[model samples]
Target: MAPNQDEETLESLLEASKTPEGRSRLAASGAVATTLRHLSASSPLTLPYLRLLRNLCAGEISSQDSFIDLSGPDTLASILLSSAASVEVLRAGIQVLGNVGLAGEVHRAAVWVRFFPDGFLRLARVREREVCDPLCMVIDTCCSGVGGRQRLEELCGTDSGLRILQEIIETALKAGYREEWLEWLLFKACVEEQRFLSLFLTLSSSEESSTNLDISLTSVFKPELLTTQHAFLLDILSKCLTERPKEVTVSGKFALEILEILKMIYNIVDFTTRVNAAIPTGSPAIDLFGCSLLILRDICAWEDARPTETDKDSLVNLLLDEGLLDFVLSRLEELEPPAIVRKSMVKEDNLFPVELEKRVCPYKGYRRDLISVIGNLLHRRKRVQDKVREKQAIPLLLQQCVVDEENPYLREWGLLAVRNLLEGNEDNQKEVAELELKEPITPPEISGLGLKVEVDEATKRAKLVNISG
Candidate 1:
């Protein structure tokens, strides 16, 4: 056939695959499948043929029959595995398998294993730049599909499969593919998918398997890998701490589990320490209770909908805990200074240096000093609907703004901060009013000589004279 005729046939097949009627015709007739197989196997497969194959596999073709006679599974796999095909062709083939959900078909799966049993493992090791969206789609489909988990488990069980995955992980690490998407996939496989976790735990439990996994993870932590994966690892660790309550036992060993994971993923002790410290403190039982609340809060907040009553109650309880509350208050206070000082310095460096230098200053002065920072935090808290905590946080913050005689300029700021906090709470407003019971000073009157007179004394003297009269 002429190249133009072949192109036209390919386009027609693509169009047919896109609609239900056409798809049914293609799948039922098997003509499309025959054409696809022939075109795919042809030497120097043209781009048009490759596109048609992709469209067919991508489920653009509605017909299941279109897939039936498109070469035997083994033939299709062999064509894909052949060194003659380009990476684009291989990717198109994998995508077709994924989109068609053919991984569930035993015959197709057997062909897949026979021809490219290690294909995913190979793709996993490819350079980050080369690991395109189609590859990710293929991995996601296969790992999440029927028999995919079992296949992964089987592969992990084998020395060769394990070796291949290990190498791929190492390559991914080295090539700087530690973004959230990749980490999320790994997290899903390790935590969400029972088989993967089971296999991982089983392997890590054994001295030999543990050694190999460790070596693989270690190889993945080369400097470039560490740099790329650090934030993602931290994110994963935080999520694990928040979400994987079942995995974390109440015993100190759970903390150890976290530490172990952190050590394996990254070498940042400080980051791990911060996360560990963030874990609520109390008796293991109470700690578990509090952590559970935190976890619930995190999960509810993550979802699109509002949290249920149970979630709200848990968050409230967590927020109201004196120790936890105090910690949050302390953080608010700690965060208040740099903002005040930075702004104050920015506004008038020389005059504000004294207040800024002090390690402990009143919150009132701090606000005056760092209005921008406090405003920003308040904005964030408000955006997140933590108004109650934000209200509670203000007083503790204001106390830090108090100024002494040595730094009198801070007194006005201290008072202002107090006023701002008081304004937010009715009880605080009343308390503030009672604290400043003295009447506000009135302006003095101008005498006939055009000089101001002391109003308080003059009024008092006039009242006394009138009484005497």
Candidate 2:
């Protein structure tokens, strides 16, 4: 075919793939091999052609199968690494692989291996708005399963991956994007290399994290701080702590791990107030708090969603091994109770009830997560139940359940914590029974609207002026 005629023919084939009838015709023409062959040659239509392959593969099982059959993975990789192809072309090629990878494990593995033989994720211009969206989608999709997740570790071997992610995180926060996607990326990196957890913690916190803390948490992780053979925690958190953290291999590390997670959650949410201030609604401080709350929720849900196994330790013991309840309950001292709950009271049906429906500071999602953490721990642990009784947690839980009216969810969580404390342990139940769960009272209810007849009365000022004379 003539050059012009061949170009026209390829364009027609591309157009046909867009519609059902065209897909049928293109299928007969063996579209995958044809596109791959043409892709090998330099032409003006190369990027457009790659984009067409992306569309064709979407939502069509047959195209996905056919593309893989014709060695589409190799073709895409070549375009991605091509010195001759433009960045636009490489990106389109990535989308096609991402789409194909969605079919199943084989295709996903193929795409994953060939997609970034060079660790392009670290190289991609994630700061640019346009380049970021599709690349984020691709990375998220590629991390769809255990196999993909395992392969993603290879992304961390190169130092650039962490450095790039750090830059994006810091930059995005300054620009106020927060970039949840980048946070996830940083999280994945940390999960792979435990040292990066410290970095993730620093980045996840408000910018003031480094300068404002009395200890300046950043200083704790300096390379010089650790001995030459630095030993990180084998059990609890690797990167989530310091770069050169003390090794913790002793029994009952789980509770300690939970404590660390809780501590970080507390610092991030309480960032504004730690220095004697409150974060305003819709401000960046609150945004960081909400974001930190989401991270906490995600942590709980992740553990909750894990598949069950018979050999697992009792939930409460796993939670209580380090006297986890004591540490966490201690942490709650900084979490202030609701202001309105303290000040507000109302009369209803001859009863003065402290407002139960208004939520206060501790009713926020992060605190609910804390409640859930306790509830999850205490669900089946006799030891935790005993500790709750011993530590007198029943009263604390009762206060939350009684005073928090604004958050039904928080109220539910509080009730759950109390229920866990009360379950299966008669002595713990008895301890709770002895505590005073009182009714609210108003001054009117106490004084009963007295209507005393007035006798001769003198004001204080009059008495000072000798008005009696």
Candidate 3:
């Protein structure tokens, strides 16, 4: 028969297989075996045949059984392994394989027996959405159930396999494909199994030159891909930290995970600020650092708000014990005063400072994000309040209580932090009252707005009282 005629015939069969009665009839008629018998490299009939078989096997045990019994995987694997398999052909064949694998253990075992490490790894490198999405399905299905744990370990056992998985994630993230499956896979491997650290360890151990893929472990976690390819990762990592069992979250079990996350944040910030000074607007570093801090902030606030708090430590105390407070203070200190304050300084000094151009946390709103974490850490917690006081962060917190064009809501978060610090602590309030205030320096804009900085002589406090009257 002519190729067009053959394709039309297969298309009709595919439509028929969409129904249960048709699927059963097609299975009984040995359609799967017949299709495999005609499978060939560069054949125009290949994709149509695979499509028909995929529709036949989808959610139908009888058709799935026929596909396996007729050595469908063997023929499909050969087509995939061929040098001439078109993207469409690979996509259709992998979809069929995914459907078969989704049936049961016996079906998945048959698929896995044929593909295992190499076949799937080869397909994973395609980077085409049509191929990668179905391939993800195939892997996800095969790695289901208790026995599939071994298959997962084996897939991740080889560096090549791990790189393939990482690239697949990067591809999906960049292209916005099949996020649910990829998210679960990463969550299982990285959080549930702690494969995230393992990936880092592997990268650290291996010579850096061996990272041959478009995305490397370093690129995936660092600022290299942060701008374009880290939304999915940030969301998944945030969920991993935030959605843990409350008990485990507080029991010090999360210490290593928190530390690793803190390390990622520190490294990214360091790389962005020190190694590379040019921060892309809306950089993913903001999302990366912001996500980590938000997780810490929420967890701390949650623990602080609880009426019956666990005595088994806490995420806040654990983080504090890990020097998170010190980290926040250090980063805050490094950030140049926000744009508004900088403007005031430059105008008053009649000179633009070159140091302002090289400010750390250069991305907009970064300082406010840092202050937010501190604000949450201080929420109704006296020990945290005392910790902040002891660390001499009171003055730093006070600085945040001013309008900064770059850091939106900086003044509000700063005020809340100060309130938390002195809510019931007379010592802290008295210390603030006694601390000497610098004579106010009014920038042209503030003077232009009929505003003046007024310091209360009795309390030695500065206030932005309206002098418009």
Full-model lDDT, candidate 1: 0.40
Instruction: Encode model 3's per-residue lDDT on 1-469: one tens digit a residue.
Output: 2334566677778888889889888888877777777777767677778888888888888878888888888888889988899989988999899889888888988898889777887887687877788887788778777567777776556575576676676667556564356656665665555455444434333333454323434445645544433444545655655665352233343344544565565665642352222223355655556666655665565534554555423556777788877787777876675555555555345433435444456456677878887887777777778888897777667667777666678778876776777766666666665553333343333443455544455554444445666
lDDT of 2 at 167: 46
Ten-residue region with minimum lDDT total, candidate 1: 460-469
Over the stretch 354-428, how does candidate 1's per-residue lDDT look in tens digits? 343233322222223333223222221222224433455533443334333323354354444343344334444
Q: Which stretches of candidate 2 lie over 4 Å from their true place?
A: 1-15, 18-30, 33-47, 56-91, 102-119, 128-133, 136-150, 161-258, 264-316, 334-336, 344-369, 402-409, 436-469
Alpha carbon lDDT of each predicted model: 0.40, 0.49, 0.66
Decoy 2 TM-score against native: 0.57
Specify the poorest-scoring 10-residue window by lDDT in model 2: 459-468
TM-score of 1: 0.48
In candidate 3, which residue pairs clash? none
- What is the per-residue lDDT of model 2 for residues 1-469, given as tens digits with 9 covering 90 to 100? 1334456676776677788777666666666666667675367878768877877787567788888888888777666666676657766776787678788777777776655534454425334433444554566566667576665655444343434344444334333332334434544544433334344333333333331222333443333332111121111132232222222121223323333444444443333332222222333333333333333222322223223422234333444454556755664433554333344444453443554443235324545655666665566566667777677665555545433333337657766776666666677655543432223211221122221111113211100011122
| Candidate 1 residue 42 C-alpha distance from true site, Å | 7.0
Best by lDDT: 3
Q: What local lDDT does model 3 show for residue 349?
A: 54
